[model samples]
Target: MLYNNITELIGNTPILRISPEVHKLKNIELYAKLEFYNPFGSVKDRIAYGMIKEDLKDIKENGKTIIESSSGNTAKALQILAHINGITFKTVTNRIKIPEVKNILRILGTDIEELPGLSECPDPTDPNDPIRFIENMVSQEPHKYYHTAQYSNMKNRDTHYKTTGREIYEDIGTVDYFLGTLGTTGSSRGIIEYLTEKNPHLVKVGIIADKGDTIPGIRNVDEMHEVGIYEKTLYDDIITVNSLEAINGMETLIRQSGVLGGPTSGGAFWGTLKYLEEVDKSLSEKKTAVFVVCDRVEPYISYIQKRRPDFFEVETHKDTIRNLSNEELANVNTISIGEALEWVEENNPLIIDLRGNMAFRTSHIPNSINITDNYFEELIDAGIPFSNNILVMLVCPVGEKSNKFVALMKKKGFDAYSLEGGIVSWRDAGYPMKPLNLKKKEQAVI
Candidate 1:
């Protein structure tokens, strides 16, 4: 695989067949398109290279540096493309992105800028907010930089249409459904647009994070954080999955396929499986579903190694509870600040603050125990009991992590609930906090 330019490595990813038993769907063929083989080790390589070339063509007429904002994979792809093209590149991302991605970006000589106050933003919407900030910077300093606004860039889709989409269509011959995670919607949308032209009945499914009104593994209308403006018009259908479902599915994929993809890949796989189940029940004819294995397992190695090492070796199917709707999960057992106080007075329930120790030390629910991530597993291992008959509340800085932790506790055979809006909401609702005080003695000025 000798290539003179990064752009030359844009398309032609390998397709592999996997056992249907692992996916838990009967009488259906499954295939995975390994997009990680791209130059940047993800499908975003095509988009990054395409957007840069098009933006450069429109702006510089000759040659110029590139600047963009990306969370992980896109930034790495852009770095590779820029390095090959002899263009200086700068990437702005938040601090909480997977550490391996930051290291790769640094290795590629990208001028990295970390956004402030981004740790609390759990979703991709806020994580991608740096795009606007970078746009502002490029507007003021236009001479030396070009911004590849991936969220809104048509080139992202164009590259996929020109390369990945065509390659899949040519290789598979007939793809009943195109499944992939919905980040910018470039990969799915591009393939849909290209393939639909040939096969009008082809289905395009976009997988989104479960937030509002959306099903756990199917589509609905919600403010998708990673879905860009282009996606609304691009996707034929959308599917949403909660964090737990995504995590569990990721574990399942690693166990079955010996491929450890990230959360987004798991979401896509789950969406495809659910779709196949529905199709199997409805149609008699055999169906073939294709999903994009969007990225490699390397960037996520550390995360899975630390949080779910058991999944690294075993491929056991875990049953996920999907009876509770997102709305039910959002509001179930949630209490307002006043209501929480009143409930605590009446029930005397144990409130476990899920926020990290630092935030818990700053201030927390009155008399709540600080069981941070560091000590959470330890405490659970120590046989800390939660009375099933009594109310148990989990609290965090914001609601997302608390919700996830509550789900984990529930899965671990505990009747637990999470405080909606967490500590921020409690303070916003006029709750008082007991600030920690350090022991200090009067001393002479030194």
Candidate 2:
């Protein structure tokens, strides 16, 4: 096939049938929509084009830079498209968890402004949320920037409805079930709308990351709120898959079916089987179902290795938090908000905040030192960085991460306790917080 421009190569992706022997579903025909076949190598290519193509001329004429709040595939696609169209592109986001994804965006000449909060989706409560930050910037200089609000834009959903949904129906007449891992929730919403017209009884299942887990290109329960295009009523069921399960699903697709899909695709595959397994038992006839293979897997090598180090043959410390036993996890020393003030005064423990540097600077527990979670993990991998006799108190946005670290530290014979409910609780309880004064600190250094 010959193409005049790369934009022409955006849609009409091929779908593959999962072997009956592999899925082992008695009455279901499973299909994988190979979205990675698109020119920029992900399902986001469709939306990137959909969001920008109409405004490309106006944006170019006005010399406005195209901007969005993306840290992954959407930013990559938009950057490439912007380059081809002779326009500048910028992305403002929270700390991108995947190193490879960040490096790729940087290499593509994307102007990235990284914030401190770790939520993959927009958080309305967060003052430094990417959407709010972009809105502020656009308000200040509307002529200087063109913000493509992917999270709320109807164009994102409409593009999928016109192309992705139409192509799937043309290939397979009617879809009995549709499974899609939710990121911006655009692709899933678009497909469900179109396919439901073909078969009103179609089951729409939305996939997300489990609470306190990070799966790239999807939102966890806390981050799911405040998304403009997402509606809970659209889905028949919502399934939560963790990083391990997502990787397991990715491996299954790669090994069993030879589909080179990323963790997001793996998550969708995992969630699809979980939901359909129950439906299969009650089904009287064979039904067709489709799930999207969101992207290729090569970019997420570090992500998979971090969660499953055994796969890469990289050994962790014998007492690493990753290897914490259930007993150790259960027995972590925890202090509530009321107890925290008294405990801090009595013990004088070395307080450690595990939130990102940006958040740490905004406001944190007085006398607390900031070591972002990833760096802290690296410190543990080398060996414990603290004295055995010293008392330690760990804190995070919420208590979950800090609790896990406390468990590992306790196993290592350190007097460590996790602050119950974390810094959020401490702030809510009217405890004093010290804000880092950047100007004063810089002047002092000079």
Point to the candidate with the largest lDDT: 2
Query: Stretches of candidate 2 above 4 Å error?
Result: 116-126, 316-327, 438-446
List runs of model 1 lying over 4 Å from the truth: 21-27, 55-64, 120-128, 211-226, 233-236, 242-263, 311-400, 403-419, 422-446
Residue-level lDDT tens digits of model 2 in 271-348? 899889999999999899999999999999998988777778988447766567889889999999898998998989
TM-score of every candidate relative to the true structure:
0.71, 0.94
lDDT of 1 by residue, 38-153 (tens): 76678888887777664555554546567776767787787776666566777876533366766777777778887643433242222235777787887887776787888778
In model 1, the Cα lDDT at residue 9 comes to: 68
In terms of lDDT, the poorest run of 10 residues in model 2 is: 117-126
Q: Which residue pairs come into collision in candidate 2?
A: none
